[model samples]
Target chain A: MPAVHAEGLFKVFGRRPADAVRRLQDGASVADVRESGATPAVIDAGFSVEPGEIFVVMGLSGSGKSTLLRMLNGLLETTAGTVRVGDAELTALDAPALRRLRQERMSMVFQHFALFPHRSVLDNAAYALEVRGVDRATRRAKAREALALVGLDQWADQKPGQLSGGMKQRVGLARALAADTDLLLMDEAFSALDPLIRREMQDQLLELQASLGKTIVFITHDLNEAMRLGDRIAIMRDGRIVQIGTPDQILETPADDYVRQFLADVDRGRVFTAGHVMVPAPALVAPTAAPAQVLQTMRDTRAGSVLVGDGDGRVVGVATEDVVRTAVAAGASSLAGLPLLPAVDVRATTPLNDLLAAAAQDEVPVTVVDDDGRLAGVVPRGAVLAALGGVPRPAAQPPVALAEAEAVPPADETALITSGGIRG
Target chain B: MAESSDDSGLLPRIPVGEWVDTAFDWVTENFEPVLDAISTASGAGVDGLTDALLLPPAILLAALLALLGGVLRSVRFGIASLVGLLLLISMEMWEPAMQTLALILVATVIAVAIGIPVGIAAAKSSRVSAVVRPVLDFMQTMPALVYLIPAVTFFGIGVVSGVVMTIIFALPPGVRLTELGIRQVDGELVEAGHAFGSPPGKILRGVQLPLALPTIMAGVNQVIMLALSMAVIAGFVGAGGLGGLVVTSLSRLDLGLGVEAGLAVVILAIYLDRLTSAFGQQRRGFPSFLSRGGTVTTTAAASSRSVDAPVTGATDQNARPEPAR
Candidate 1:
């Protein structure tokens, strides 16, 4: 069962909300509300959130994202349609029921940190519980646990004024957590913060969500942030849901022009990791070595490159099966007789975005390796594109040349700079 | 019966028209003496002045000093005090100005005593604002002269009457502005109270009142200045300060006394204006310390010191973006 379900949710602010909503049902959009001289804030929106899942709603300002959030808690009574939290219909609940739900089932973290400047960090976190008349001892213990969860236990007594912006937001999160609600609603909670602080808070929420498993509905305008945190994202435009899908699905196939433009220049490779997609290396003996030994190493590790050790077990060279074929095709040296060529190696720990540019500019396949720098596998250009939710096209289509190929590496450059296609 | 034929015989050529014209000429010639005998009015008198001087001077002093302190609080307006001194000396009305100053001081003390509590009550209760709002409206719109008639009717025309009228005329702004200041306090701060599960009244005491005070005090400053202006007008009803001197001089057609007394009023007005204005600046000039009625008088404020501290941490250190709620 859905943790929260909102069906045909509508909010129209005007002297005649009913009339305006009727007009909306008759095919008048939010714009028509103005054309007919009324204010229609939310119109015909619908979505369901599963328990223990992170659902993100993304939109630019005035796209009704904030209004939709307000409606979830009955801060605004909807003009039309029904909303339910679990089996309890939120729209039908009276004030007391709604307040009970807010205190016990749904805890909200507002964008402004909403930390009381006068209260100590501990007290701010414990506010929601206190409002519900949770006994002081239980509230304090829970608040401390929540604070420690956010790594703010040390600063419990510090007032918001004394705390940093990020710390204050952590306190806000702790407050929400201390409520021990089933659903945590965050309304662009980090938008007011600076970028670096924003990133930190995002990580904290993700961490908290993983361990706590509370059903979460996070609202944000930044698509990258949505991609980072959302289990599923619903894009909103002009009071309407444009598209809703998993991040990969949305990135790969945007619903329409609006979304395509929104995702343009969106660096997908940053979100993709080598662990998800890498071609397993094929193993065989160099003509000079035993095939059995090569087969043993290849069976042990399914990576793309094999290391050739000297008589002293020191690495002499590395072999990637794809690279051997390429060298033979280029007629540089036949793979049949030439010792395995060590092209270039990178660790799996390196971020994928960097690998894209470096491999492309060098016009060579990069070898993936263990932390000890031993060759483990190789990642060709095709694997990078495939991991990015883009299907690898047929062999006839040449790989798109990496941008750095047209230019020479500057003298004072690191290998990652030349190899990694770090999208700006 | 005998005249008509007799007149014709006596003057043979004199007409009746000639007789009527001569009679109207006689009346016009005698018009001034007739009017002088009919109704009368007084030109100007010393009694009004004497009555004005007999009133109390304390209220006048309160108004004057509040203005003076308010203005002197701002160094940018340094010329006001010197200019006020010059005006007083040139008009030769120094003694009356001092008396007015004394009265203004006393009135301000009374206003503060009464207005702040009323403001606090209004801030705490909506019902209070409802009751106070209309009263404030009435107080603001009622004419200053009208206040004097009631003062005289109730208090019998003295310095006490002047104080009563000035307070009546000036008190509303204090109440209205104080309430406004309190209500405008950030809602977030109020919610903090809920977080503590503190009563609304307690929240008001701890959070709302302290933040609202600077603005309310500003309102008080305005009330004092207004009250000073009304104090002089109260002179007409026998509430004396420097107001009496001006009224007396005007009565005697002594331009010298009139000018000097007017100058004296201006001096007191300036001093009150400066002092009240200075206090207001000190409120907004720096980030005032958030002391809850703790007598937060910080001199030589540290201007524009860094209020923002950097958040330093590992990758997530700067995370202050309002998280989605």
Candidate 2:
């Protein structure tokens, strides 16, 4: 079963909420409900979070993303429909039962770090466990471990008032982790930090999620953040979800003009990976293939280069037409013996932004390799440039390239072939 | 009809004073048992506290108070307490000073005990807040002396009557500030408590109470100041203290005694004010013995030595980003 399944959820605020919900369910619009004096904060919202998935809800302020999250956790009761978390129907649970569910099964991290100023950092991290009635020694040990995960074990004795905004937010994350729940709901958990700190936090959360594998429903107004973190993102607008898709899918085929307009601000290079733009390997030849046969295959495909894979299907290197012709003239038996061009190979998950220099310098496309160095696909220089230019910049904001290029580390020569082309 | 319309012959006189007298008489006649029990209990409480305070040698008490003030507040306030207490002793007002202190202390403790829960309730519910607002207004706006009439009638002329009047006059700020404090706590923090599955009671105890304590302490300070002023007024009802001494000195035209008694009241006010306000300003992480309450204080230190400089340093450490790895 999916970890969380919410269906037909509606939360109306102001007077006569039930009646407003009835009107909403009867096909009245959010504006219509507002005109009638009851504000429809969330309207017929529904989705499921798969186990170990980062399901992000993305929207601007007042889009009811937060309201929908609260409904899933049973903090705000649904006026219209149901929410099932695991096997339990969360909408059916009473207040005490919901509290028990929140205690044992789900935990939340807040936007402003919501840490108690009076509590020590360790105590703040241990708060959720304390509320669960865990024994002090066990809870403290667990809290220390969680703080260590966030690299804050040394500051455990200090109060949160002494910590900076980033450190305070680490305490918030630690509190959620210490709960040891399978499900975590984070409402803009990184939005309060400075941009550099925000990116660092995003990297940390991704690294943490890799090992912990908790099901998380993260909420954010920043589409770029949603794109980076979400395995599948749901776009919300005016109390309704307008689209649900993976990052690449949303970029390639936005559901409506609203999503397209929102995507205008996204730096596509950081979000789109090699896997997103790579085409099938151009021409493949076994490493033992005769140089004559390699030349014949490259001519048949009208390709400039061909990938040479060994018995394991892992690309050894690329052989260009000139290299193959030279090898043929020199009477080499197999393409493996020929001097091959240095085609930079990268894992499919490498961000397109990281491949810019490699793609710009090499004549051959960047090879996409799987975990065992097996051939996957190839991202060409043109594909990388096309992907980066897919979205236009918003007129008022500066272009993202200048700042982002500065953020890239000095190129690593082994992984990136920045100077050479086809070795003549 | 024309005569009635004129200012001098407006209408039949309303018997507001008589009606109030009748109301007081009815309460006195009907609720005598409950009133008597309260009077006896509070009277004994005041007597026990006054005797205990007086039992300590004045010099010993002064030193102990000075040490407490020094450790909990700052060294400067501590020295001030020592000097002020000695001056009160030199003027021969030590006994009456202790008497006034006991009265104010008892009244403040009682006022705070009852006021906080009411304030929490008011903060939680608009109905309770609406009902409390005007009653607090009336309690605060009424003259401090007017409370003495019912106080004397209810408990009879003594320290009990004085304590009762002081409680009434001092109660409003305690309630108001407590409510304001709880109400002013960040809404996101409360939402966070609920999101973490804390019940309402736990949220109130663990989250609301600690955050609201500074404001509540401010309220307690207000209560103490108002009680000191009102306790002196209660002396007109024959409740013996420095107020009685001042009244006697006034009657006899003895300027020296009046000045001494007035000076003693000032010393008591300043001491209590500083001590309670210090509780509101006390920072966390101090030795448990030095800390007054569990809450964290945001105010800087009053002394020139700058004991709180480390706290500002801690904040600055995280304010800037770490250098690139």
- The clash count for each model shown is 61, 0
Q: Where does candidate 1 stray beyond 4 Å?
A: A86-88, A94-97, A118-123, A133-148, A152-159, A273-381, A389-424, B1-143, B150-164, B179-210, B228-232, B235-325
Model 2 chain B weakest lDDT span, ten residues long? B316-325
Candidate 2 is scored at a TM of: 0.87
DockQ for each numbered candidate: 0.09, 0.63
Restricting to chain A, the TM-score for each candidate equals 0.75, 0.87
Per residue, candidate 1 scores C-alpha lDDT tens digits across B1-325 of 6897887788767677667557656654566454223211100112333335435453453345334443435323334555556556456665566555545555666666777779878977899988988887777666656676545644455666666666666676677667777887887556534433355665677678766765666677666766677767767766566877767877799998787776667666656544553455364442232331123333322211111011011111212111111
Error of 2 at A181 (Å): 0.3
Top candidate when judged by TM-score against the true structure: 2
lDDT of 2 by residue, A56-145 (tens): 999999999999999989888888899999999999998999999999999999999999988999999999999999999999999999
Report each candidate's C-alpha RMSD, comma-separated, in the order given. Answer: 17.5, 9.5
Per-residue CA lDDT of model 1 for A177-243, tens digit only, reads 9989898888898998999999998988888888899999999999988888888999998888899
